[model samples]
Target chain A: GAGVSQSPRYKVAKRGQDVALRCDPISGHVSLFWYQQALGQGPEFLTYFQNEAQLDKSGLPSDRFFAERPEGSVSTLKIQRTQQEDSAVYLCASSLVATYNEQFFGPGTRLTVL
Target chain B: AQSVTQPDIHITVSEGASLELRCNYSYGATPYLFWYVQSPGQGLQLLLKYFSGDTLVQGIKGFEAEFKRSQSSFNLRKPSVHWSDAAEYFCAVIEYGNKLVFGAGTILRVKS
Candidate 1:
């Protein structure tokens, strides 16, 4: 079976440009999550979705970061006006249950703001 | 705030040597603990998890972790490591919002 997948494995953008990252979760996965991993650091939670509902977005850094999982199978993370600080790898994960389940992660999209 | 800690930033061991990576969490009760491995330019791979019962849990790739409630620790151990095991290891815990809080990670360097 296929695991979680993300698009645009690498992205390069100029400062102030907008960027969007896509994630395709595993089939029938009810829970999805997004994380950001900075260079030489552990990944930090960004947001979570259960089905089509955006249950938690507390980890989103600022108003510029927005995520949507309209149909519950695919999710997107968008950033308005990219900055150098936003240069990092964005990771997506999915699980069979809502919580306490093993999260299968995608390869992630590395965004580089030049 | 809840957090996970990996005391060692890096560890270098010869092939076939025993290995242990420490992990500690700050939480009121026992939370779901997990160990994950990530190779360069790859996503995290679940090694094992400890939910309940059985303090010692075996994971894939010949890895095991022991959870100690009294110590608030879940340390990963391997009897003999292989050269291919060189990668980054992370300790994570499911916090209040069902999101994982990860530690700074430990880089394992296996010398053959």
Candidate 2:
């Protein structure tokens, strides 16, 4: 793809429901990242992947949040028992082989927990 | 721990007026700073970055930012504002392993 692509641009989930968001990073990009952006706030780091290896999950807020990149190209962020506070825009980004390179971001999935 | 601060929650500027958005960061060493712009229904787009070299860096959309190490500030500026420039701006600092720590964003409103 030309850029990072995210699925379900908008999702409305009832409280306690589980939801999954997907991301397709750029071809052969070595680094991928997930972030959470609340209304009127900047994106916060959620997790990072270096190829198929999940090197950093430190930013995951709680046990309810889980992310995986099985093939190193596609990633999924799953939220269990979604709460009202979980409503936010989930963003996915990818960078070239060099970690410090500029990240290309997806349009983001707006999750609204009812 | 690395963190960024954008003091101005909202800024309004008239078209053709000069603009400046303030940002401050706290990190232990030389920081890898970045400025990004986010338009409605769009993803963040990198404006500029300060990895090393000159303190002043030019970016897309006629934007520029200066990194002042002594003050721990990386402020974004533009010589003239345009209505199309109305959007949210964010400052971020890179941590080890390419993790980015972003600040609360500043919403810019350009008046025509």
Candidate 3:
């Protein structure tokens, strides 16, 4: 099985445009996570999901950021009215038991908002 | 709150030389630590992790990390550096349920 997969490895969007990033976690994985990594910075937590339930989204910068994982397989992170500050590499990860276990990460989607 | 710190921004080393990347963490209780590496145009690969019991943990790509509870650090090390090892290394800690808090990252440049 694949570790984790994110579509459109690179994206360029105009300001105020709506965008969506997709993440497909490992099959049968119960935990899914999203993170944002600015250039030269580490990945910061964006959201977490367990079995299709979003447990935490406290790290989302603003109301324009939203994510959902229906049926707990694939997840979508949608940004409404994108801004320049939103430009970064969006990463996705998945784990088995989800108790600090080893998390497998995707290649990441590099989003550029102009 | 849990936090990870990678003091060095960039490190340069010669091939076949030993390498060490420092990592310091802050957490109230015992910390679950990890080291991940990202090569150019590649996904982040887990190098190693430390939960409990073992102080020294070995991982893929001939890398190892030590969990020093008293020092509040989980530093990654490799006995011999390889050209392919030149990449960005990240130290991370788990918080809440399954979220990871990562350090700013350290870029390693291997000299031939």
Which candidate's DockQ is highest?
Answer: 3
TM-score, B chain alone, candidates in order: 0.98, 0.98, 0.97
Candidate 2 Cα errors over 4 Å, as ranges: none
Q: What's the CA error at residue A73 for candidate 1, in Å?
A: 0.7
Name every residue pair that clashes in candidate 1.
none
DockQ of each: 0.83, 0.74, 0.86
lDDT of 2 at B80: 97
lDDT of 1 by residue, A1-114 (tens): 999999999999999999999999999999999999999999999999999999999999999999999999999999999999999999999999997888999999999999
True contacts kept of each: 0.82, 0.70, 0.90
> What is the descending DockQ order?
3, 1, 2
Cα deviation of B12, candidate 2, in Å: 0.5
Give the TM-scores of the predictions, in the order they appear. Answer: 0.99, 0.97, 0.98
| DockQ, structure candidate 1 | 0.83
lDDT of 2: 0.94
The TM-score obtained by model 2 is: 0.97
Q: Supply the global lDDT for candidate 3.
A: 0.93
Tens digits of lDDT, candidate 2, A1-114: 488999999999999999999999999999999999999888999999999899999989999999999988899999999999999999999998747777889999999999
DockQ of 3: 0.86
The 10 consecutive residues of candidate 1 chain A with the worst lDDT sum are A94-103
Best lDDT among the predictions, by candidate number? 1
What is candidate 2's lDDT per residue for B20-64, written digit by digit as tens? 999999998889999999999999999999999999999999999
